[model samples]
Target chain A: MSKFIGLIRNEHMKTFRRLSTWIMFGIAAALLITIAAFTAYYAEDSSGDWRADTEQQMQDLQKQVENGDVEAAAVQQDLTTMQYQLDQDIAPVQSDSLASYMESVMYYCAPFLILFIAIIAGGLVSTEFGTGTIKLLLTKTPSRFSVLTSKYVSMFITTVIFFIFFIGFSFIVGGIFFGFNGFDAKSVIFDNGETVTNNLLASTMRDYGLNFVQTLIYATIAFALSTIFRNTALAIGFSIFISMFFPTISFILSRYDWSKYILFNNVDLTVYNPGNVPAVDGMTLGFSIVVMAIYFVIITVITWFSFMKRDVTA
Target chain B: MQKQPAVEIKQVTKVIRGRKIIDRVNFSIYPGEVFGFLGPNGAGKTTTIRMIVGLMGITDGDILIKGNSIKTSHGAAMKHIGAIVENPEMYKYLSGYLNLVHFARMSDGVDKERINEVIELVGLKNRINDKVKTYSLGMRQRLGIAQALLHRPDVLILDEPTNGLDPAGIREMRHYIRNLAEKEGLAVIVSSHLLSEMELMCDRIGVLQQGKMLGVQQVHEMSSEQTQMVSFQVEPLEQAAIVLRDMGSKKPEIKDKQIIIELTRDEIPAAAAKLAKEAISIYGIQAETKTLEDTFLELTGGKEIV
Candidate 1:
């Protein structure tokens, strides 16, 4: 067991010691700062007249629903949220508030997180082969299974570190742009044809958690590709390609019943949240979890088999 | 009683795509001995080393290190073996100390002091903290050896260890490898195509050719065998050749005004006496010791070592 941890420590040392890994963190931090600055700059100073703005938004959404210019269900949901804000004496979350900025900015930052995690996952195994270090690595006392598992565990630890870094860094940046006074603010969500209120921190954490799951699946795909192809660039490129295009491809294939079985279609577990629609009519959160579990198992098997059974000629 | 062999390769064969790459090669390396694998390129030297190191699978027989089969109990068997398959390819981005620490972590019971000991042993103490990319190839090779020796396995396998090293570095490596075998009682397996290097470095050498083991012989005995080419620089080369033929020298040839005959060291005085009796002036009589290169070429059917 200590040997296993040692292996992981070795992997961590290898990963975190590289300049590219820190550069990834720098880029992520810079991007979040830019996003926070943009949000702060465009935020209108409506602190004293938020009630009137809420009433106007509710009226506009009601008109859009009656005219059939927008989907009635979505517009009605928005209208209900605004009406609840007015009745309950709760102000709508503004772009200048820390809670609202964090909740929204994560949605923008999730893709970059996935991309960075994919880069790390993609290079974890393939770089050893490229650098001819795999020969030295595999000949050690540990079995191939141990070595591969340590690498995967290290990648997972790195993913979690990236997540915490993103969330923490975004919090500081967002707090700097907007005062950190919205900890107890309530977020209005539309769930099951009803306006529901949730603590802003809880709701934002839920979004971040869901995004983390998405990043993990994508990182797994990249890691599997790294093992199979043994090329970092190809693995990372193909992962990004799949992440970018699979949603659109699944959308085009949504007309068919089998489209629901596509990994991309099921990867977005957020669609199974209370109010959002599944890409296919019947994909439950449970069903998506099972599909992802199956994919995770299959990828794990392929990766282990490829790593353990092959010769280390590289 | 003889000591037990540290590593044993018994009838090991490797078939890739229905072609035999290593065929029934058999050998055993004992503790306190430096064994060399001498063969031309494409002769399964690296493949055999890879099998012993558990980097490649054996199709037929098994390799055992310290009585543990590599194919069956890989981790247990690998515990007794430390190796550098080809180049000592360390992570270039890591410092030399971290590279040692990285490999040291993979094995059992290797601690900080052991890491530092290997660093000093390889003489990389001053530059141990420098990143590998800034080091010279010779320094990288030393770092590679440091990593391989970190775990203190009973068997140390180095495939083409002197490759890409300068002459002085090669000599230093040769001396270090020999010292390791002699003082540390480690079984060392070194593979190389350089015949002269093997002659200087190895205690015993196994000649491999086309995936077949020709033979294994002691390094000293290989060159100093019974039969040697004894050349007699005589005043009359033709008369000396005639004398050698009369003396029952098989296939005596005259070249460069000398009569050259394949004779044992015991036959030199008799041949000289016979030449003097035949009134042939023996100006010079030089016995050329057969080099490992000559014997290797003869064993591998004169294939180029490359």
Candidate 2:
């Protein structure tokens, strides 16, 4: 119906023109840049500021080995062995530049777009309550379900675009700053001598593609919080707390065999492989996605019904 | 002239958080009738009005719009009802005409020409195309009326149309509301704390006090007791009392302008002639008219509505 569409358009405009939306974009940009900076620094810093003393010690050991120092030669040999092991651990490592830097950064940074955007998403519903716009809406048309749906439709559409925009922005930066040869770049060293390698383009594109579904879940959570709380500040607070802390609590719980059933335990799907020494018994990426999808749907359903029935008198 | 009610609110009681917001309020407004809900601030007028439009749920009773129960189907109940609880929110960025058109799209049984017709009916055709942000309070009020009537509702309930307006604006709103009831045969229930404004505008008023209707009476019928007021303010208000104390007049007291006398209809002219001879210049000769305010205070036992 044109009425429903008009409601959506108006709701969309409510988010698109806000200071918080732009602030979200700013946070997203800054996060991408910061994550890229951190990755770039982490990769090249061994011979640079962070590990200057280690590089100096290696040079000194090599000199001693050349000057017929037996103890120093042994230490120099150990140093070479350590370096070889480190190289083997980080096998298939790509060159560090702004482009490759950003690729690595986005894997972590894209998830945070949910946090940056959750504030506006909360405000999308809560503002009507705080500002008393619901009275205006109900006075004209009294169907509370339609009104709530219109708001969700607006945020759903906008959040999708926001997710797409960030993915697109990071990819553009990746293609421009890092060489296109990174189409095959993969494999990276992690702590504990672990190596993660894959077809860079396919996995990265898959992650980017999955972001559409992921952001929708986040948006629905934001909506449920908004409708339940009726205050933008409170809604955003709850959403942020859940997003940031849920995964952490789940990670700590993963030490127990029972922890794998926790929804947040499956958050880190990128490097996790069931065939490898998996953390939990029989937990797969498909199962986790399905579970999280159910959680999202349940929250959305509760929001819609509650919003329709609750009194907007206050 | 009498007609069937377009809106009926029966035994409605609304309690929120252990506080009774509306208590057993009952009234029915017929088509072509301008019903004024007279009350002071916090008198539960808005709550009652919101219930009529189906924006709120009644705690104890029901509202019928064109005989349709609000509880059973509010969307259909709302179809016959148009209302402004306060100033209805208009999209500030859009033109007034566009705003009406948008509301029209949501409502059933409205056409594009109806939108234009309502624009003309509210007498805002000249500036309906202007963005509402630029509209004056009066212009916006008119646009609000236009939107309320977009679906051709049978009953139009306005909480406070003249709120925050200058004298001229109040008069303009009064004229428009009365016209809507008269010309379009829309049943109108306008609530206001300003008794004088309601007196000037409303045909029949229901005085509300403490969430209860004190009584409903016509503007003329309220003052029809026909009190005779005679007043005179002398140097010593009690001094002139001694001279007129021995008269056939009963308990004549010196007030501001004339000596007070509650005279029979036949005695008014004779008393006035005697007072004139005594040089008590009759600046005015009229009954102490019972305004809606006086009626409210009189009916509420001199206590404020809230």
Candidate 3:
């Protein structure tokens, strides 16, 4: 156990000392601060009373649908959504609260989170092979398993800290601009195909948890590729492409039956969360979790086994 | 007068794809000895070193360090060895001190004082805080040596340690390596293609060719005692030739005002004395002793080293 801890400390020191690592954090902070400033500055509260104005707008839309001047299907859908919001006591306004900003990080910035984590994970082991430091590392410990496990454990800790920083930084900057009220406001979600009300904090926390899982899964895939190929470019490039485009592909393939078993179809565990839709029809939260669990085991096993058996020739 | 060997390679063999890369090679390295591994290119020197450090698998035989087999008791055996398999590849983004600190934490019982001691021993105290990427090749090599010594292992194995060193740096390394072997009682194994450097740096030498062990011999036995061409630039060369023939020297050829004969170091003086008694005027007598280079060339049939 002490040896394992030593390995983790060593890995962390090596990782955090790099200038590139600090640059990544800098980019994340800059992007979030800019987003916060833009949203705070451009926010418009022209309605004066949002509930009364939105109710009037909803009546106008309903009148248009009734006159057969617009597509009834689309207008009917919008009316239904607005009615549900009114029922849940949700106002149509630019909410700049701490919880809302945190929610934006969970929703809008998830791709960036996956990108950063994937880059780090892809380069972690491959850089050792590229620079020939694996010789020094492997010689220090007897078991290769310990060396690799320490790296993964360090990555997990780094991911958690990065998540905390993102949320905490967003909260502080957003609160400074928009104040920290309305945290107990009601948010709308779909449960069992029915629109329902939920607390904002509970919904935002749930989304954060789901985003964490998504980031971890992508990072693991990148890590596995690092071991298999020993090239950072290929690993990182392929992971980014998958994270960005696989959902699109899955959407197109959803018409077919086999899309349900594809790995990308099951990665978005947030579909099980209240407000999101699953990639494929009839993909339950339980089914997606089982598929991802199987994939996780297979990826972890292959990575560890290959790393242990292959010679460190480089 | 048998002392226990610090490292023993007993019939170690490595095979890849049913083709032999390292045949059943065997040797032992003892404490207080500087053992040189000499070989031409593609001689499996690096492969053997990798096996010793537990980076590669052994196909047929086993290696034991301090009586612990590397195959069966790897962790215990590795605790007694410190090695740099090829070039000293370190984390370039880290400073030399941080690198050492990180590596020291991997092994058991290496403290800060020990890290400082090694840094001082390798003459890297001045630049220990600089990033490794900023270091010259020689400085990197020195840092590599310092890292290998941090654990105070019983054996130190370096492959081509002097590859990028300048002449002065090589001499400094040679001096430091000899001191470590003598004063600190660490068995040192160094592989290099530089024959003259090996001659000065090593007490005993082992040569490998085509993944096979040619033999291991003492430095003196390999070079100083071997027969060499002794040439005497003398006046009346034909008469001197006759004198050398009368002295029972074989095939003493007189060419270009010189009489040359193959003579061991002990026989050179006698050959000169016989010519003096014959009243042969000898202007200059030059005896050429075999160098490790010449011996290596003769052993491998004139294949290029390195």
Candidate 4:
């Protein structure tokens, strides 16, 4: 156990000592602050009482529903959600585009975090192989399994640390621009055209939690490729390309009945969000989780086996 | 009483992609001695070193280090081995001290003082805190040695350890290698194409060729085989040539007014007396032995050692 811990520390030292890692974090923090700053500058403040505005908007949507609009059901669901928030005495968020921007960032912009995390995971093992440090590392007392596990453990620790930093910094900067209010607000979504409600903060937390799961999966793909190929550029390039473009490709393929079984289709756990309709029919959170779990296990097993058996000839 | 060998490589073979890279090779390295692995390019020297350190797998046979088999109990075997395969590749981004500290953490009982001691041993105390990237190749090589020595393993394997070192650095490395064997009682297996360095550094030298072990011989024993080269420079070369021919010398070549012949050490004085008796004034007569290079060339069938 002590040896494994030492290996982890060594792996962390090798990774964290690289200036590129710190610069990546710097870029992430800068991005969050810039987004917060942009929101503060361009987002308009509420001109009147938020409750009254929500009530009026609900009435207008009700009228549109009564007039037999083409999207009457969705409009009606929106009216019901607005009425629920109004009845709860929670003033609707008052910014033009900055309302709950933090939650939105956590929800939709997690790919940015995953992108950098993938880069890191890709470089972790690949850099060691590329730089020929694996030769030195493996000659030590630790088994190859232990060394590989330590590298993966270090990657996990780095991911969690960076995640917390990104979230914390986003909170501070996001709070400064938009006051830390509206957490008591309800998160309302239309599930299959039916209105569903949740605590705003709770649902946002769940989204961020699930988002990390996706990041783990994406980072695993990058890491597995890195270890298998021993090339950082090829691993990062292929994994990032898949992460960025797989969804579009999956969307096109989902027209086929079996597309839901594809890894790309199931990786985005967000589609299972309450009130969010999955792009493919009959897909559920439980199903996506199961599929991802299988892929995760298979990839992990292959990577571990290869690392353990490979010859450090180079 | 006989001590067990520090490293016993028993019939180890390696096959990559269905082609044999190392074929049933066997050798033993003993404590308190430096063993040199001499081979031409692509002769599986590094491959054998890799197997000894557990960096590469053994296909057919097992390598034992301090009585632990690398094939079955790698952790136990690896605990007694420290190696720098090929070039000393390190994390160039890290400072030399940190690199040692990082490697020191892998094994048991290596503390701050031990790390400092190794730093002093490798003579890197002056530059231990500098980033490895900023270090010269020789410095990196020393740092690599320090890291390998940190764990105080029983066996030290260095493949081409002096590859990038300057002549001064090479001499220093050679000194340290011999010093470690004597002072620390660590068995050192150094693989190099530099026959001269190996001759000066190794106690026993093993020649490998085409995935085969030619033989292992004590350094002096091999050099002693060629200690009978006699060359005579006579004032009258024609008379000396005739005298040497009459003495039944086998194809003595005359070059630069000297007749060179190969004879046993006991025959040198008699051959010189015979040449002088022939009325040929002997200007100079010198006896010299061939270097390890000649022996190596003879063993490897004149193939160059890369």
Ranking of candidates on TM-score, top first: 3, 1, 4, 2
lDDT of 1 by residue, B49-76 (tens): 9899988989999898999999989999
**Candidate 1 Cα deviation (angstroms), residue A231:** 2.0
Q: What fraction of the true Cα-Cα contacts (under 8 Å, chains A to B) does candidate 2 also have? A: 0.32
lDDT (tens digit, per residue) of candidate 4 on A137-218:
8888888899899989998898888778867776777777877666666666667666666776677677888778888888
Of models 2 and 4, which has the larger DockQ? 4
Give the per-residue lDDT of model 3 (tens digit) for A16-98.
89888888899989988888877777666556776787799898987887898888877655676678887766864356666
Provide the overall lDDT of each model, using Cα atoms, as 2-decimal numbers. Answer: 0.87, 0.71, 0.85, 0.83
By lDDT, the best candidate is: 1
All DockQ scores: 0.80, 0.32, 0.69, 0.78
Candidate 1 fnat reads 0.86
For model 4, the stretches where C-alpha displacement exceeds 4 angstroms are: A56-74, A96-99, B222-226, B232-254, B263-287
For model 1 the TM-score comes to: 0.92
Model 2 local distance difference test score = 0.71
What would the per-residue lDDT of candidate 3 be over residues B227-270, giving only the tens digit for each residue? 77889998788888887885433689887778888777777788
Residues B1-306, model 2: lDDT tens digits: 556678888999999889987889888889998899877677788778877877777789888888888878878888888877777567776688877866776787679899988888888988988888899888888888888888988888887889888988888889888888889888889888777777777889997777888899887453323445445444344544554455434788655545675554455566556655666545565645444566678998998754
lDDT by residue (tens digit), candidate 2, A1-314: 76777677667766765566777778777776666555555664344342444456567777877887757745744475445445544323444653355456556765576776676677877777775656667765537788888888787778777767776777665555554454555533333343334555555566655555555666677778889878788787876787677766765676798877665555545535312333476787787787787776788788887787666665
Which stretches in model 2 have alpha-carbon errors above 4 Å?
A: A26-102, A176-197, A256-262, A266-282, A286-290, B17-20, B40-42, B87-105, B109-143, B221-254, B259-282
Worst 10-residue lDDT window, candidate 1 chain A = A72-81
**Model 4 interface RMSD, in angstroms?**
1.0
Candidate 3 CAPRI-style tier: medium
